[model samples]
Target: MTHDPRTALLSAALDAAARGWHVFPLRPGTKRPALHGADRCRTTGDCAGGHLKWQERATVDPHRITLCWQTSPANIGLATGPSGLVVVDLDVPKNQDNSNSSADTPDGATTFKALCERTGHPVPTTHRVRTASGGHHLYFTAPAGIRLGNTAGTLAPLVDTRAWGGYVVAAGSLTPGGSYETVHDTAPAPLPGWLLELLQPAPARPVVPLRLPAVNGSRAALAALEAECAVVAAAPEKQGNITLNRCTFKVGRFVAWGDLPRHVAENAFQAAGEARGLTAAECRSTIRSALDSSLRKVRPRETA
Candidate 1:
């Protein structure tokens, strides 16, 4: 007998809810959240008080899961924080260039293994999910009395963690690339003490105002560059790289117009990002890539 796709998806959602995971619906065949974002809120239904983000709205209720999936074949989204989980997302390299054009360039799993070895710890066996992109998500129970946030490239290259404000596609969910499947069907183990030490958030630091070097640029351009640099310098910990990328991209039009020299902006933002505790390498890569993308898409000066 041919199985109904909606039934299968509903089953996936219910199964996740059964595990005490706060579950939500992902867009069918995609990883993106299916719920309307804050901008689309109409102050109705779930938004009666205010707009609730997907993470806040995620529920472990089987009835809600069934109702949601009964309407469409939506994929399953698991809110790691509400579920008391910290998922280490080990991603694969995107292309040959990112892989350093070397056959030996380690993927996320390999790098994580090396990290484990260096720390003199065995790889923790826990609930594991294989992503559609040929990557792995190692699930661990979060330590009590401690709240952790998401991280990017903090553990290692291609290693990211999903915690508060982040979610992961649960096992049995389907994406265009393939299905997210359970590889290790076991209860998630408590986070390893050593790994917890590595993931523990640093004490909050006060953000200092940035001082920019004078550069040859239009007055407006200079002001804009300085403003964006301050935003980078004051970015919250664990969020510096994204803030730097966004702020740098916003200022890239000045470089394209020759009002701000590319190197001047690059150097200034690099310093600001580093001051915010981002690694030098992470800042450099994010700045260059954002600038390149912005520069390519910028309209001609005369058009502006």
Candidate 2:
């Protein structure tokens, strides 16, 4: 016997809950949620609450899934940060055609691929979901110890990350834009360490001085720089190369602000990459590419 499409969807939601994913109901044919009064929801550190919006109360309970879907056929939306998973959301590029098809060769995918290639980072071959607009959702287990935030263009233009304070429509959801479908059979892979480092905000660190100053004891600060050097020096093959570049670029900004002595900072950056096993030539080339611009172009820190 053919199962009702709505029933199949409800069953799918239950299956997701079984995988320890919290889910909420979305409108039948759109990413817009089906929760009532969701717009009026608010939360605070001391207290949190929402209006009728179901997202304020998404659940993983099988019973809750049944109650939600049975009440009305709804799309499935996975809350990202709350679920400890992050999704790389490659959105379909805009089109004047308005052909009404979800599938298309949008700029987001191309940009993402180029970024991966440039970073020497491998695109994940793990669990993926195909979005209606020909975009894709690459899912990964959030790395421990870093709070990743949702961002657009943090990685590349048209590419977005859904982490804390964000959500992604699940694979089984149907939207007027299109239906989400699983593209890969495997479970999500742990997010790559190099990528995690890139996603995380850089720690606030003062630049190393030309010589130890008698001004004050900041031995701890110097040690932190040493640790950063270690990470670059030991970065995994090509994958870590981009991270090293990014690290150097951040340091260059400090140099631009006069927070770090340029000569001292450069020597430290070179040492870090070399320590991470990079050849002197490789380190020199990357350091130049990454730091030259910021030094030439960045403005000094602004006064309050």
lDDT of 1 by residue, 1-304 (tens): 9888899888878888888999998899999999998788998998899999999899988888888899999888999999999999999888745546666556889767866765678888999999999999999999999898888866666789998889999988887789999999999999988777666754444656677987778999999998999888888757777788789999999999889899999999988987887666556666876788689879988896
Evaluate model 2: give its lDDT. 0.69
Query: Over the stretch 215-234, how does candidate 2's per-residue lDDT look in tens digits?
Result: 22245434544555666766
At residue 14, give the lDDT of candidate 2: 88
- The true-versus-predicted C-alpha distance at residue 93 of model 1, in Å, is 0.5
What is residue 197's positional error in candidate 2, in angstroms?
1.5
Off by over 4 Å in 1: 96-102, 204-304
Best by lDDT: 1
Assess each prediction's global lDDT (C-alpha) against the native. 0.85, 0.69
What's model 1's lDDT at 184?
93
How many collisions between residues are there in candidate 1? 0
Error of 2 at 49 (Å): 7.4
Query: Which parts of model 2 have CA positions greater than 4 angstroms off?
Result: 1-3, 38-56, 96-106, 204-304
Find the 10 residues in a row with the least total lDDT in model 1: 198-207
